[model samples]
Target chain A: MIENRPFLKFIEHLVLILGVLVVAFPLWMTFVAATHDAARMGQVPLPVLPGPHFFRNLDVVLNEGLWGGDGSGVGYMLVNSMIMALLIAFGKIVISLTSAFAIVYFRFPFRMGFFWLIFITLMLPVEVRILPTYEVVAKLGMLDNYWGLTVPLIASATATFMFRQVFLTIPDELLEAARIDGAGPFRFFKDILVPMSRTNIAALFVILFIYGWNQYLWPLLVTTDQSMYTIVMQIGRMLEGAEEAPQWHLIMMTALLSVIPPVLVVLFMQKLFVQGLTETEK
Target chain B: MASVTLDNIQKTYPNGFKAIHGVDVEVKDGEFLVLVGPSGCGKSTLLRMVAGLETVTDGSLKIGEREVNNVEPSKRDIAMVFQNYALYPHMSVYANMAYGLKIMGLGKAEIDERVKNAASILELTEEQLERKPRELSGGQRQRVAMGRAIVRKPSVFLFDEPLSNLDAKLRVQMRVEIKRLQESLGITSIYVTHDQVEAMTLGHRLMVLNGGNVEQLGTPLELYEKPASLFVAQFIGSPAMNIVDTKMHENGNEVTIAQNVSLALGGGRLKDRAGQALKLGVRPEHLVISEEGANTLPLIVTLVEHLGADTLIHGHFGDDKTDLTVRCSGTQSVKVGEKLPITASLDHIHLFDPATEKRIEF
Candidate 1:
């Protein structure tokens, strides 16, 4: 970029364009497949371009549900996924923010011990302790519900650690000033600490939203009811039909629909997300 | 306004490191007291203890009649301006100043009135009040900080080197403004700084501290004209006082300063301790150029600094080659390696006991 040589510029553009194609090619294929009917999609050579039956496929997917999985419409599963994702994201942020605040500001007995206890959970993520977590969830009568889907996944050590780092970067004098200003601990946290870390909260929300939205394994284990199914788990179910061939067009359409919410979240909050991750605004 | 009293105040850290020893000071109502000391001398610690940010480990601290050792900073009715200004970066200037008042549960109209009044006093513009701290220049941010303290209308104002971050020119300007503001408000204030000039100008009375102990507490003129100890003598003056070792004359009427040069003690001031070894303290400006005489010592000039209004000549004197600095008029031109005869008036000479480092009365 600094040198501005013609050959180097050409080479840079060529590499960038190739990278874009590499990433976007599969997404383009999914769109084309969603626009065509299953008959055209299963042809010897798959259609490269979108077909005219896009709206018909969309209506069928919206109303009739995937043919192979539970017959609950895609709309209902989309609603379920949206609820689960929002709950998980908001739950993780609230729990982690308060925990990080308590860890950073307060000095109680065994404070670091508590911090390390939370930190140790990072090494034992959902995959490693799946059986024990599942046993606890089942024993608590939380199975086949949103509680089982979201609550078990909400205590995020990574988010807590990130917020702790952000709080630590704020000057100690700010706390003293707040204390002098007659602001109690809770008031200080609300008026000063929370607002100062606005971008960081936004950034974490985007990441955690996507993380919740894409949850598959835990939802697959917890929910048995058709109405309780999330979009991500439904896609896995759509691929495994015992008597019928996989509906490529409808599956692709659901895949395309499932990707939209998280993508929109990223697009809307991209500025704050980048700012939160890259810089401490204060 | 209320007086602040510290009765045998002490601070011992949890790690067993005692930062502030038992020290007592009484600041009268509407008085400006400055704590001046070098780094690690516990000046800031004492100020923070007064502000209730630090715990009072041993003794009673009172504001007016109330013992505030256990009181919260906000309830104690004290406001402190930090060394770094510590303005809330997210809040606008108006909000920053109004924060404390709002917390005190003042009505919206009252908070608005107080904030706007303080802004006018500090000369902060309406536009500036709407801007965040980071958006303003350093001086503007400093004014906003002062505005914050003023809006509270607290009993005491504690300033911890608030002007230390400013450039030299701005520091002088703000120093005068702060003095004027304090005078107009008639509020008791405790200011901390290591800069002697700021201490001399800002405080009605100055407390010079060293190694966590109070060295002297007196007016600026009292400290400069008669420093109680050697530590204070050098610390209070710029370019420092020149200290040299000497012995009292056997006759009790003269003191031998160098190998051969001797000064007559006209009043026989040291007659009680004749022939005893002592330290001689002389301000550079007090020494004047003179012809060779019984009181005059010849100095070999090593360096000459022309400071526009005055010339400072760094030199060594007599056979033993004692180091000395002589301040003279700028019109006088002197070169290095030149021997100049210097003499100090008998009244201008200060004597100290070498063993105790305490100044002796003539």
Candidate 2:
């Protein structure tokens, strides 16, 4: 039994390593492809070594236009993605904070029943409502605009649920202390609730950023003009226009670039995210 | 300083549980009052109602001739130190103390001045003031809570079991500190606690509550020497009062316990209500190991507790099913299974009806 245990453990480690590579293969391949030119890309078994074209291909993305210089460039799409992700994160955070605070702390009418309704929205998948959501946005003539991109998902159930639990975990004594300090509801939220919940906000910011950044289906369905397309949509168009045999190098690079910033953000705020969930003991 | 008056105060929980039944209480200007009770009593709910945190449900609560029932907590001019010491964890001790003053639009200089003065009064160093609450010990957080309340300089101070969260030794120390602070400021303060010793030592007047009702309200000595009901008699003393069973006799002292333990209470006004069941209560301290006294009962010793200044003897009467407690002065040599003749002075004996558990009229 003892002799076979080490071999069994070796098999377990191999499985774990294989599992990690499987999940991260595309991301790893993107970075690998970013360094290689179109010639090195088709080599059998792939080029595992780094090439010098890292910044060269980056400049291609930075300088050259996508779809044969049809519109602005990938830079425009990158900027648009940044704007959409940040606005969605910021806007969703504010709405969640105010709504969650009111729902959790205040004695408003039907507060629990209303929260149950908000919870139900979480179960309604975005795909189920896409048709009606598109029609509403179209009727409002908000297509191909930043609001069209950001506003539909701004009223979020996930952010609200996260914040509601966070706010509920704050001791009521803190609120009473603030009140005794001459603070009103507005001041109490700004001064006490917001600052006390910074960890949760940081965690939720990463979650919302990833949610908005990886949004390809909605952005593709909503906008036709490439001028206002998000980074994901730009990547999609870049792959689609490759004529029979796609540019695996550029497609993989674009996809890898899409995942990097959010990965960095999640890694940076990972401790805060776990802390937010574990702060129930407080 | 402010005087607080509650006329016909009532609090009925939404679940139809009446927490504070119609209670009328008055706190003299600059007087410290303590509302004390066991858990599930309405002491905290009462304090919150006074602070405008809880909706009163019913009553007229006036602070300094101002009807404060409808007033916001801030406009009510009162500061509260919570049991958890609720100092802002995110802010430094300085910010926690100064946040109120800043909101009041006090000048930055004045805010700094008040916060510093309060910090010094609390013995919080300048370096401590700049540090966040998480860095402070439990006692330090409690002091910071007081500092925050102090900086406001409100007319009244409400403490909701403020020292209950501290360790045993720290609670006693902080309790004394709070009393001294209140004396120096002479603020009309209402303190709520389940600790009877805290109420006895700190309050100028004490209100004992039970089951959402003010059982008795009087000065500490008054409640100690003369509780208005059976509950207060048992609630006031450290070891509960031993209420031996008795039967009332006509016109004179005709009450007697088991084992022919009988005494003619010199002047029981309840002489008119005779031949009915009655209660004779005496505190453990008053139930001494007597050499000779009018009302005497023999007891069987069960346990002995030596508390330095005194020895507490757990015993029971001859034929009664209930146990008895006798508190003798200083540490004395007493053992289990030893019998002692215990008696209570007439003046110290408390009388109540067994059925209603209400004290007989004097």
Candidate 3:
């Protein structure tokens, strides 16, 4: 990057173009596949360019349910996914922020012991403990509900640790000054700590929103009702047409639809996200 | 507005590390008192105890007539300016100053009025009050911190080395402003700093601490003129008081600093301790260049520092080659390896017991 020789510049542009093509080629293929009808999609060599059925395919996907999957339309599933993602993202941030605050600021017996206990859960992700977690959810009568779709994935140790690191960087003198200013613990948290960590919360919200949006296995295992099916779970179900040839056009359309919300979230909060991750302004 | 009393104050951590041990002092109403020492001398801890940030492990603390040993910091009615300013970075200067009043549930109009009044006193502009703390300079931030304390109108003001964060010139400027502000407000205040110059200039009275003990507490002039112990004598002055070892003369009227170089002890101050080992304390500025005589000591100049207003001559004196510094006004033409005769008036020469480190008096 430092030296600007012509040969080096040419080599650098070549590598960058190759990297961009490698990453974007699959997305281009998905867009192309969604533009064509099912008959053309089923042929051996797929269409490399558009086939003029883009709006028709989008209408079919939005209005009518996928032929091989559940009869509930993609619009319904999109609403379900939106609710689940919002719940999970918001729930995780609230829980992690409060827990991190308690762990960092207060002194109690077994304080570090409790912190390490939460930290050790990082080793046991949901995939490893899915069966037991499912059993507990079912016993609690939370199956086929929004709680079932979101609650099991809400406890995030990584987010808690990130927030803890953020809180640690804030100077201790601020807390002392707040105390002298007659602010109690709750007032200090709400007025000072929360506002100071605003960017950090926004950044985590974007990341966790995508994490919640992309959930497949947990929702698949819990929700038996078609109306409760999230977009990601619907995509997985649509792939399993037992004896029929899968509907490639509608499936690709639904896949494209599911990627927009998370992308928009990142786009809107991109500045705050970068600041949260990189800046220790205080 | 109120007096603060510390009666036998003590602090011991859970691990049994005692940071402060049995400090007792009373700061009178509307008086400015400064606690000063080197680092780890427990000045900050003692101040925190008064501010109710640190719990008093023993004894009682009082503000006005109330015993506030277990009171919370907010309930203690004190406002503190921290060493790093500690202004809330997100809040505007106006909001930072008004925060204490808002917490006390003052009306919005009253909060605005108090903030504006304090801002005017601090010479902060209206636009500056609307800006965040980071947007201002260090001295401005320090002024905002003082404005925060002023808006509260607390019974006492606690400053924990508030000027330590500024550059040297700014520190001096803020020191004068702080002194002026304290006088105009006339609030009982306890300021903690390790800088003796700040302690000397800003304090109505100073408590010099050493190793968690009160070495001496008196007016600046009293502490300078009659330091109670060797520690106070050495700690209070600039360039430090030059201490040299000696023994009392057999004649009971002089102290022999070196072979054939004895200073006559007028008034027979050390008559009872004749022939005993002693320490002689002399301020660098007190020693003058003199002709070689019965009362003068010889100094072989090693280094000369010209400070524009005064000259400092660093040298070794006497047969044992004890180190000494003689400060003289204006630049001197003294050279290295030159032998210079130095002497101090009888009243300026102080004697201390070498073992106890306490000043000796007739």
The candidate scoring highest on TM-score is: 3
True-structure lDDT of candidate 1: 0.92
Q: Which stretches of candidate 3 lie over 4 Å from their true place?
A: A1-10, A68-71
Q: After superposition, how far is residue B148 of candidate 3 from its true place, in Å?
A: 0.4
Task: Please give the ranking of all candidate structures by lDDT, highest first, separated by commas.
Answer: 3, 1, 2
Which pairs clash inside model 1? none
lDDT, candidate 1, residue B48? 96
TM-score of chain B of 2: 0.95
Off by over 4 Å in 2: A1-25, A65-73, B249-251, B267-271, B291-296
| lDDT string, candidate 2, A33-71, tens digits | 888887888778897767878887777776775445554
2 against 3, candidate with superior TM-score: 3
After superposition, the stretches of candidate 1 with alpha carbons farther than 4 Å from their true spots are: A68-70, B251-253, B269-275, B318-321
* TM-scores for candidates 1 onward, in order: 0.96, 0.93, 0.98
How well is each residue in B1-362 modelled by candidate 2, as lDDT tens digits? 78999998999878998888888988999999999999998889999999988888887999999999889899999999999998888999899999989999999999999998998899999999999998999999999999988999999999999988889999999989999999999999999999999999999999999988889899999999889899999888798888887777665566777656777765665667777788888888887787754456778889899999989999776654568888888888988998788777777888887778888865
